[model samples]
Structures are given as C-alpha cells and as structure tokens.
Target: MGSEIAVRVNGTLPAFSDFGSDNERAGEVESNPAMKVNTSCSLIIHENGKPTKHILVDTGNGVCNSVKQACNDLLAGRCVIDAILLTHSHPDRIDDLSLIVKEFDNVHVYCTQNCWNDVIKKFPDLQSIQHTSVEAGKTFEIDSVRITPVSVQHSNDALGSVAYVIESEGRKIIFGWDVLTFQNPNDPLLKGADLFFIDTFTYNPHPETNHLSVLQAYDLLKIWNPKEAFFINYSGFADFKNAENPYARVPKKPMTSDELAAQVMSDTIPWGYGWNERVKVASHGMVWRSTKQIEFMSPQFSEDMVKLFTEQNYVFSIKKGKKALEVTAETDIKNISYEFIKYDVESEGRRIAATTKGGFLAKPLQMLLEIDDSSDPAIVKIKVGGGTNIKMIDQDVSYQKDIHVKRVHADRLRDFLMKLTS
Candidate 1:
C-alpha cells in the first residue's frame, strides 16, 4: 500500500523578530506572526486506514493541539504519534516535542546525535522518550516508512540540521525545512521525489538571513524537478494575502527579459505557484491522496453535487446538455488577490440581457465543455466572466440578476460531468 501525506499545521517562526514587525513593507504582517501555531506542520502517514503511521516532521509551539485535532478529524480517532522526526533542534521546530509525547505512549524520536543531545539539554523531560540516532546519508526505517537523512546548512551549526527523504512503497517525499543551502546540489536524497516541502522564509531576491528565500527555491525546483512542491515557513515580510496570484508582487521597475527571468520563474506570483504547475503553499489541514479511488459519484441531477459547489460560497451549476456539458458560475472580479491568465481568452462576448419582461439588465458568466471519447484531451474553454463589469442604471436593481464570472477549471468540470452523466 502507498503512503498518503496530510499536513496538520503549516507555518514557521517569524523571520524578523518575535514581535513580527516589518517596517520594510505594508500589509505584509499577515504572515502568521501572531499565529505561529499555524506555521509549523505535523504530518500523518497512513495506508488502507488500518495501520496509521504518524510521523511528525516538526513540533513548533502549539502544534500539538493542531495535530491532536487533525488526527481526530482525518483518521477518525485520537492522536497516535508513532514517531517524531526532527529536522533540527531549533527551538521553533522542537519546542513542543515534550508536550506531544506526554499524550502518547511508546513514541520514538529520530534525529542526529548532535540534535538529540541538544533536544535533551533543552527539554530534559524528553530523556524518557526513546531516541534513535540518525547520521547524514544513512537510511533508517521507522515502522514501514524508510527515511534518509541529508545534512543541510542552517543558522545554528551546533544543532546540525538535516533534511529527509521519506519513502513508502513507490511514493517518495522530500521534506527540507530550515534550509539555508544544500551541501551538495546533486545529493542522491535531493533527486526524484513525488512531493517536496521546502522552506520559504523570505521573498526578497537577496535575503540577509541563512534561511532559503522564495527566489532561491525557484532555482532549486528547476534542478530537482520534483512532481510537486510546496513552500513552507513563510515570514512576515513574505507575500501572504496575495499568494493566490500568479505574481506575488510585480517588480516596481522594468528590466530586460533575462533579468526578469532571473527573478521570477513561476507563472503565479506567490512563492510556490510560478516555479511549477503542481507547486503550492502548504497550509494547515491540507490532505493529499496519491490515487483517485472514486470514493463517491456526482451523478447528474444530484442535489449533493450542487450543495458541494454552493458550499464554496460561489454560484455555479452543472447541466447535462444534449451535445455537451454546460457549467456556469460567477465570482467577484474586483478581488485582485489572484493574478492569473488561462489560455488567452479564445473569444469573449458581453451584452446586457433582460432579467424579466420588465427589462432589468443582467450579466452572466458561462463556459462550455465538449466531451471527447477519443484518447486526446478535450479543448475545454472556461471563462470566469466576460471581462466586463455589470452595469445597470438602477442602483437598487432588485430585478437585475447578478452574474459575476467565477473561474473554474474546465478539465475538473469535464471529469465530473463524464462521471455524473455516464
């Protein structure tokens, strides 16, 4: 059975100071300084829902609470901490290990010899917990998961930080946090990963700290070429609110194509988005299942399917047309949080239509999906809106039916339609 990874928490310590102050920019303080508990991630690995292997990568302050909740929510049981894996002895990463172990029994803690000693020094009570020393380039098995520790440079060399390559069955994940620089670019552990969770403490091109910057992560992704990647450990100065956009922040000054390419490589502006199509910023309670087992079906005319889309707080519908499937939805176009372009609008139209016989103006967002039984992928064109604002003379406009275009992935809609209409 293949292992599935789920994020229990998602965050890192403040890059600047404990106060989370950043005079450098405005509106950047939303990066979890007040809520450090949301920054650190605790992951649970499971297979077949029988033997769940709970491997915690880090235990930042207040993460134990998040993990406990996640276990109950995801596994449908109480927290079962099978093992605790430490990337380093940084206080932010290992502060809550003692508290977490208190809630469980027979928990094994894995880390480097130096890190283990430091952990013991910091949390003397953790001495009772079983310890397994790991060395760089050596593989260790904790339950069914095989992990290879690879040393990486961080601010504090005394603790001796190391990254990990966790493999189960044929799937593999590279977890590298608190990373400043890699010892070897071609390290065997750094190659061939299904998913990579790395550090992104700063968003600047030239970061003063030893931690990895967003731009640096882009370069690493180009070299490693993982199937998917996620940026963790964001700082206050990093772009937090506008992470959904193609570009986190557009450069104020213009430069040559070569210079522009050097800075931003990804299509989306956020640290994770533009570097690779699959890469995204890791968040709390994010669950990833390797294979789609088709657990449930969304048949046509099912109210459950509409409820699923309605729960998103957006207006949308899936209609089974004779020739094809039709999907219509609307989202507020005023929100600039997401900056993206999809397939350069093949053709668009906008006209004021009648909402009723009284002639109230109404605008609508529409997309058409053509089903192709052939091997080739279908050309699905989706329009969030007609790229125009809805204008009605009446301010109250009670009769006007609102239609602000909502962008939906055509492929996903197509797949659901195939299953529902099948």
Candidate 2:
C-alpha cells in the first residue's frame, strides 16, 4: 500500500475480557491468552495518510469496547464503518451485529444469504440496515478496497459459512478464521498473499467447533507462502492435562502466547526459507504493517542519506498491558507518513528526519514509505530502529528540550481542511 495497510487484533475469543467466564481464569488460564472474540479488523490508509476505508473481518461478539474503539479510530473518530465481512453465522461471530448497525447506521454488512437470515432473525435491530448477500467467487468493492468471498468448510450449524480474500492497495490478505478448510483451497486469489489471518483454534481437533488445528494452518502457510501470517482464535481449554490427545504434537497443556510463539518459530525453522519470520501467534492488539518502495519521493537525498523506514522497523510491536493502537499519520513529506519530522535537514524542499537525540541514521535518509504509528503517539517513545539494536551513528546527541506538532492517531481530532485559509 502507498501509505500502508494495518490490522488491529481487536479480540481473539468469544469470552469477555475477564476471568471465570471461560471455565475459570484462574491458574494457567491467566496466561493462556484471554478470549475476547476473534476478528481480523484493519484499515487501508492511502496517499493522504488518513484512513478512508476500514474493513472488519468476522465481527466477533458484535462490538466490544476495543472493537468499538478500533472502528472509531479507523473512521477518524466518526461513528461510521466502511464495511463488515461476515466469516460465518456463529452466534459468537455476529452477536453484536445490531449494536454495530445501530451505532453506525450507514455501515454496510457483507455476508452469505444464509448469514443475512441468521443475523436479521436473531438481531431484529438490523432489519433496516444495508446488507449485501456475498457469493463465494464474486468480488466486491468498498471504495478502493476489493474483497472476494470464498466458501469454507465449517459446521452445518449455520445456514452458510465463508472466508474472505481481501485485495487492498496492492496487498492481498486472506482472513479465513473459524473454518476447517476452504471449499476451494487452491483458488487463484489465495495465492501469493502479503498477509494472512487464519483460524488456529486448537492444536487438536475439538468436538465443538469445526475450525482448523494449528498444524493445518502451518501446512497452508507452507503452501501459500504469504509474506506473513497470524494465528488467531486459540482455545485455552483444549489441553491434555489428564487426557490423551489424538495427536502427538498437541501440547499437554494449552500453550501460552509466548510458548506458542516459540513453538511456531521452532517448527518453521526446520521448514527453512525463513518461515519463522512469516508465522506468528497473534493476540489482542497485535499489528502488521505492509512495506513498499518509495516511488513518489522527490530527488531529495544526499549520498550519505540514512534510511528511516527500514525492514528493522517493519514489524513494530505494541507493548503489553496497554491497549494497542493502529492509526494513520497524515503528513506531506517524501511520504513514509511523518510522526514528527523535527530536527530535520531540508533537501530540495523535502524534510529528512534529523535526530534530536541519537539515531540509527545520520540524517539525509530516503523517505520512501509512509510514516505510520503502531500505537498511541503519546506513549510511542522509540528513538530509531523501532526498538531494535542495530548499526547506528554515534553522534553523542541529546535533546535540551523537545516539543512536537505531530500527526498522531490517538492525540486529537482530524482536520479535514488541511489547507485552511486563516
């Protein structure tokens, strides 16, 4: 994507954000990844560096506080939603459909014809909403983002079930959670993806839901070879504390997020081709940003120009404990959207980031990608290299005092009239 496309892990399970609700949140369950209804929601921000399109895949538990906050962020604080792609008709998946529609009245919902009947009947408040009955093969568009619905094998509990392969700003992402397998796994649209958010409910098949096991998700990752993948909707209860699981690989206990990450890394290391960097166990507030060439930048660099947006800063992490924030940075630089281009050296009218304190680069870096903020700018306190220790220029620099006029997502209201005549 020009600016970038970003995904926010709003929720991961059907449980509330507290303990006891899911069997019991005591003991190991405390770290077993609290369930909050899984969904792969994201924003597609284009050249302006402001999100004009937001996509929600599988509205799990309807709209919780975190999910509501995400919708607000993507809509620029406006009570609106661009579109919602329903993955299946499970009650947990579409429980709050009416609430979402009631809040954002104009929000368009995309689901199967059966899903429409399922939701409308269950949630009568959505009777007047605008809904599109999506087909398996037909591709639809909401602004510049194009989405193709694909059939997936799940329980017959719902009238129908489907997955989505989304095409946004030159990136193809597949969001197919709560599925055993795709009806057409080899569909052309599923190939050569930039990112994938797939169901990894349990390591072993469960008796309740028809979702993919962790191994199955790994197999698909090997076949598709997406630039990156996120495993979501993990079941903390599906452990073998006293029971003999069907598989040898199924953990004796449910793997914590850290344990899952370590196992995923270990498993993919044998597969080679750097699959370790490609797959991850996604949790609430996890984010993935797309990287591309800065073709639109002017000839505004010195030979000694340092790079600001490098692969080192590609996978930015949100700190634990606090809520994760993924919002757009609207700026008019060589593009990598400027969080704040202070202490800059101007090269042919374009500003390059000069470090007030120390930096990985010695200024004069190419600004080829859009500047993006992975979290609340207030707490986004990182120097250079995005919290990674890499090669740096030893300038021995420090800031006397610093102030900022930044394009931050969580800071303030978006000024629609950028070029306002005072």
Candidate 3:
C-alpha cells in the first residue's frame, strides 16, 4: 500500500447555473477556467505514488463528462472507480448518476436508504444495477479503507442525507457537504481529522436553505481541529450586503475575487493548532497530496509495441529553422543518432501526447517518429495506427488541439506519405 491519499476536487459549485444567473459572473466563468464548475470530487488511493483505486463521491449533473476526460487524459485509461458514494438525491448531485454507471465497467454504488428511495423514484431504470442501501452509523469496508456514513441534518430528513468519514492507514478524511449540522452533535468521530471537506454557503444563514453558512461551519470546524480543511459547495458572494447579525461585519454589493479570498481567509484561521496553512477553498482539479508523493510517470507504450519501431533503424532529416521534418527523395531519410520531435495525436476518440523529457526518454519507450520498411508500399508516421493497442501518457502534449508538433526531424509526414506512396 502507498503512503499517500490524493484527494482530487472534481467540482465545487452548488450548481453550474449559479454563475449564469448574473451576466458579470457568467462572463467570468467563461473567461476564467478555474471559475467554471462541474459536478465533482473523487478519492484516489495511491500505491508507490501511482493511482490504484478511485472512489467517486457525488456524481453531479455534468460530472460524468469531466470524469470521462479525466479517465482518458489524466489517468491514461488506467484508473476506474471502484465504488461510488452518493450523499443525497439533489439534482446537482445525482443527475449524472446513471451516466457514471454506464461510463465505467461493473461498478457498485452505495447511498443512504432515505436517499436510495428517492434515487429509485428519480431513475427507475437504475434499480437493477449493482447497488446497496446504506444506513447512517453503519460502517463498511472497501479494500483496505473503512467508510462510515454518519447522518447529518440537511433541510430534509426525509431524503436521508449523510456525510462520509473515510479512514485508511491512520489517515482520516471527512467529506461533508449540504449539511446543516451533524445530527449527533457529540459524535466522537467528527473531531481531529487529517483532511476535512465541509460546506460553505452564503455569508449569512438563510433558513430555507439546507447548507450551513460560513459562520455556522466555522464554529464546527474549530472544534474538529483538522490538519487541513477545504470549503466546498460555496455560493458566498452578494449575500453579505444585508447582514442583520450584530457580530457580523458588513460588505457591499460588488465582491471581487481578491475580496472573496480575504473574506474567506479571515474566517479560516488556525486557532492555536500551531499550523501554518488553515482551511483552503477547494477549486476544480485541486489536489491535496501526501508529503511522501513522488512525481507520477504517465503510462508509456508497451514493450511489444516498442519492438515494432526498430524496423527503421534510426533515420531522419531535421530542419531546425521551420521546426519540421524534411523528406522529398528516399535519400532525404538518413541514418542519424536520433530524431527528436515533440508530438501529439487525437485520433480514434482517444488522446495521446509524447514529449522529450530530460534526454533519451523516447528511445527506451519507443514512441518513435520513424518510417516503416516492412509494408509493401511502406508507411511513414509516428508509431501509431489502426488496430495497434496504444497507451496514453500524462506527458507534454496538446500544445494546441488536434496534433501539435513542437519540432519534427523528418520529412513532413503528409508529404512523405503522398509523394513516396503515390
């Protein structure tokens, strides 16, 4: 087992539509990639600094598409969700539940009984999948991880919302959201966690809403005394202008990103815990990693595939001025020490990116930009083609969409294919 648990914040907004409500916020959401939200949050258990098991929490309305991209791009088709845990039946949280089940092969889902009933009514077609009805205070095991679902007080006790407490290898994590407060106030399990994810709503409490205000959550957070805390599911601006509370300070209508940061910072203070970093506002794609994490090496080609490229025996003519490979005559392809080209390909509904790291990373991996003499007419391209099992790497790629080649040391691939073959 690896020593680190990587918490990837897949999504953070209450709903994507929250930003669309106002034109200015909508513009910012479009302009700033970080401000854009999706349905999110997943836990990746790492072994030897590589991802082994993935547990997804809350598949929001658009999370499946994002998860699909992550599965292909970041994970290089290596990781799949071992299990999915649902917190409630809110549209923003469970709308994409069916999509996620279909995306992955053979996955199990666990949701509280109260939530499960609503889930079935919402998607009757999903009743037959591998699913389990869980109850609050029940503890279950997945691999080496222990998960306990503790019921929390949301607006509806009828829907049966609960927060998950995950423990593994002496590391405890609380993934709490859409909460009013813990139903059992004095539950010993709520305190002293290594990673804490709590809900932060408007600056002031609104009785009609299910979520806890920043102040209410703050009071509970101080007692928990976690090493690191992140506030997710936030929609905090524009409500502070009308604070009726005597203790609360006032802020006006326009809240810049800077002011929001400062406002959030003031509330998230490390009160005598001797910690430097207090609570953080979790953003999309944010990762909270263990101190022992090593740089992940993305999946490279298989050894069998690498052996296929040796047919060309190191030949290329590189034009440094134009940053392209040059070949007109069959004579232009010459025997050289190496032909270094940084390239990307998006084909067959999958993305592959190759880059030169340090030096000589490609030769051993055999991500070759070479010509094949085995075919009758001969084929000239990167070591990728139809029916060839290709693997993706999280290395340098996609400088622009489609295929972006930083530098190629051979004939322009299209010219070589058409001129020689035709």
Best by lDDT: 3
- What is the C-alpha local distance difference test score of candidate 2? 0.57
Error of 3 at 139 (Å): 0.7
Error of 2 at 420 (Å): 45
- The models' CA-based lDDT, in order, is 0.55, 0.57, 0.60
Regions of candidate 2 where Cα sits further than 4 Å from its true position: 14-35, 71-75, 206-208, 245-247, 292-422
Per-prediction tally of clashes: 14, 10, 4
lDDT of 2 by residue, 257-343 (tens): 556666776777888878876776776655566753211111112222221222212222211112211112211111222222323
**TM-score per candidate:** 0.64, 0.65, 0.64
Rank order by TM-score, top first? 2, 3, 1
The CA lDDT at 273 in model 2 is 78
lDDT by residue for model 3 (65-152), tens? 7676667644547658888999888888888888877878877888987788888898898888888888889899998999999898
